[model samples]
Target: MSNGTDMALISELVARERLFRARHNPEIRDCYYADATVATSWQQGPLSTFIGAESKEVDPRFVIVGSVSTPVVHLNGDKAYVELPTTTHMRMMVNGTLAELESYRRLIYRVERRDTKWKISRLTSINESDNLRPVIVGQDLHVIPQDFNGLRSSYQFLAYVRQAAGGQISQDLLGTDRPEEVERLYKETNAWLRAGV
Candidate 1:
């Protein structure tokens, strides 16, 4: 396909991703390649983990309120690379007060033409910044403690844990002395993470 066509297809796919994030619609998965992979700056593991992290029910208050710039695309035959820079402002009600987080992210998508259709084969995201200031919005305004610093977000931490478990499984499969123990730990860790989420 021509470069313009490739760019258009990739741009559409990125827009679809944003829509999917806001809506949490499972049908959006159709836009991805069957064996697509994803890696993010703040998170590790496969794309499925990221998808699972999204809430099943969309919260009306927690909505994306911002605009995204046009993506820069590079086309190479059947493959296209796209870089999309976006700044998103999310607002939600927390403890009866309005809370907001402004996040800047650059998303890279690798789209490929498969069977006459374009599909995203891989996606990578770089989190530029996530600024969350404490300011109560009510009859009385108070500052809340910012205790979430120096700690990975829940999604990033969980992804690292899952990656570690996978590594342990691989090592155990390589004829480790304590295969049974490693297997047990892997299963337990997986179960614990799943339950916590």
Candidate 2:
């Protein structure tokens, strides 16, 4: 990245990205570039599909995710790379029992500016780790859901819960278990930013 990068401008875009995903605000299109793309374990394609697939009903037991680390941004002239570390916390009924799934991931974003408008060009994620547990303080998970059968351990519970909720996931998503894929993503996007493409 060139020294001319204005981090302040890039930071605002990051803030708007988070706000656009918040429950209270529903202006998703306004926050993202018209052609932004999103790729993750649960969904891969347009940004709309990723956000639209989420359940609209409000429930305290569940949340889309919880960000644990501040965003790490790399700003170039008209493009930037942003990475936010987050954890997913979702509680739901699994096999007639209340269970929660917590998953850790790195949210990657490719931001760009055109005609003086800054927005996300692509959004991707890399799974780190995850676990499942009974929501109740003293309860135990007895029956392991069939959906969790052949998922990657890094985000197994997350993939299982999402699929059980009528959503599909990509089993070949980038994850901690696959160092090569992670390396590829980082290298490819970083090159994009440097090339100013």
- As a TM-score, model 2 comes out at 0.82
Q: What lDDT is reached at residue 9 by model 1? A: 76
| Per-residue lDDT of candidate 1, residues 154-185 (tens digit) | 22222222232242112111112335643564
Off by over 4 Å in 1: 41-43, 52-61, 64-66, 92-97, 134-197
Positional deviation of residue 175's Cα in model 2 after best superposition, in angstroms: 0.8
Alpha-carbon error at 34 in model 1, in Å?
Answer: 2.1
The number of the candidate with the highest lDDT is 2
Stretches > 4 Å off in candidate 2: 1-5, 52-62, 144-149, 163-167
